[model samples]
Target: MSYCEDTIKKMLPKAYVRKHVAHEIYVAATHFKNLVPMMDKYVYNDGTTKDLMSLTGTIPVLFNDKTYNIPICLWIEESYPQTAPICYIRPTREMMIVRGKFISSNGEVEMPYLEEWKNGECDLVTLLQVMAVMFGDFPPVCIQPHSEPEQASCWLQFQRQAEVLSKTDGSFYVSLLREDDQPFQQDNETSC
Candidate 1:
């Protein structure tokens, strides 16, 4: 096996967090050669430390309502060179849409498998491939959310639900917050 795969194998056996696909994710990322572009769009380039202290970082922002995780931040942690990086969500007022000049992929409205991506068997590379196969044909567009209060309320409700469910399972709950209140420092890792 290659270095990344070997590293993943080593980590998987010692992982304490149940349901953590960290190693699996790293393995897929290293093994999949064709996914380089997509991965870079979301992840920090090799050998570079991600500066997440600004408004942007490596974490991906995905909505529970979508098919493929769109308009996301790809996050890598300081422990990444030794451990798997953690991906997180970023909430934006601008309707989250696939970043492209043309509509190549459909938003959650058309993609059904997106909502479960994080916890599903699919990893970053697989998710990108699926995005190309399913959404590559269309152009990109600005996705309008339902409404301000409606969106906030829905997010709040989901946060509550996620908390309740996560307590039973070993899953982590993510919250939607304003850009100013962003808990992490981000430095626009991605141009978009």
Candidate 2:
């Protein structure tokens, strides 16, 4: 089978396991293709692998010393070609924590600091560009009252360490990976 077919076939079972997983993989692959080349060079977090794509309106924001990639999962009807994907990122032990948002794909409820993504017009390239512009180095910093005060603090530390790390460490390092997962693959000729 052709590479695309093979990749799709390999992904089919996992996709079946969870539609979101498949979608995440697809989005990651797409984002990887569009993102990596643009980077002058940088290392990904150890063991970090791109999972399925979930629509997140959360633009990357810096508060304390850490970077938080936020996404909101909202209830979206099944209307292919018209309906955009509803995906979100929830509060995790190691990442940013937000209030009233559990990371799941069911509901139309509004979220805090949501930035309503224009899914119909968005693509992997545009998405990555958006990420780079929003969350890229030298983002404007701000403090919010109440709720995620710790998150705000984390960003401060993250940036300080990141500066030192960037200067002292190698910019290019292969990320650790599980045997079951393959690195993202890109087709130069393909368009999303």
Candidate 3:
């Protein structure tokens, strides 16, 4: 038994109807070797926290003829197969979350597979496979640009300008400036 298996056995002793939750996790590990299971405290949106079993690691996604390892975390509730595991895209320090149709700005994943999860039909392995496919179609994150000292200062200036512009109801300027902070060519005819 691996550490994850042991932890599952120890933490979930109630032996829920889906008594093979640990076994499912073990199978998923065999398929996605990079994923490692651990128990962690997961805080809910309502501010409640629960110690839950989670698998954290990267899943290989082939995009544009190249493979990228997309980091992810899956939180399995105590109910096991009765409920779908909560999933999130956990980008690395060099990456930034790209809010898309299937992913939220905060990195929470929402897809048809999770929304239509059925008790005996949905499993961790299949869930991961689906995520790989969906992510391949629309990546959940992108590599953020490395900022030099000068670039950082420029970004701060843009942020300050955006703040002032936002206060003055310059919604267009606020949106454009906050998007990427890229320097835009000033047109003499254009004024905020």
Highest-scoring model, TM-score = 3
Name model 3 segments beyond 4 Å from true: 1-8, 11-18, 148-192
Descending-lDDT candidate ranking: 3, 1, 2
Tens digits of per-residue lDDT, candidate 3, 37-89, equal 88789999999998888899888876545566888999998887889999999
**C-alpha lDDT (0 to 100) for residue 187 of candidate 2:** 25
The per-prediction tally of clashing pairs is: 31, 19, 0
**TM-score of predicted model 3?**
0.72
RMSD (Å) of each candidate, 1 decimal = 15.6, 15.6, 11.5
Model 1 lDDT tens row, 16-73: 3322444545544564422211222333437555333111222232332223323433
Name model 1 segments beyond 4 Å from true: 1-3, 6-20, 34-111, 118-121, 141-192
Runs of candidate 2 exceeding 4 Å displacement? 1-6, 9-30, 33-80, 98-120, 136-192
Question: What would you estimate as the lDDT of candidate 1?
Answer: 0.35
90 Cα displacement, candidate 3 (Å): 0.5
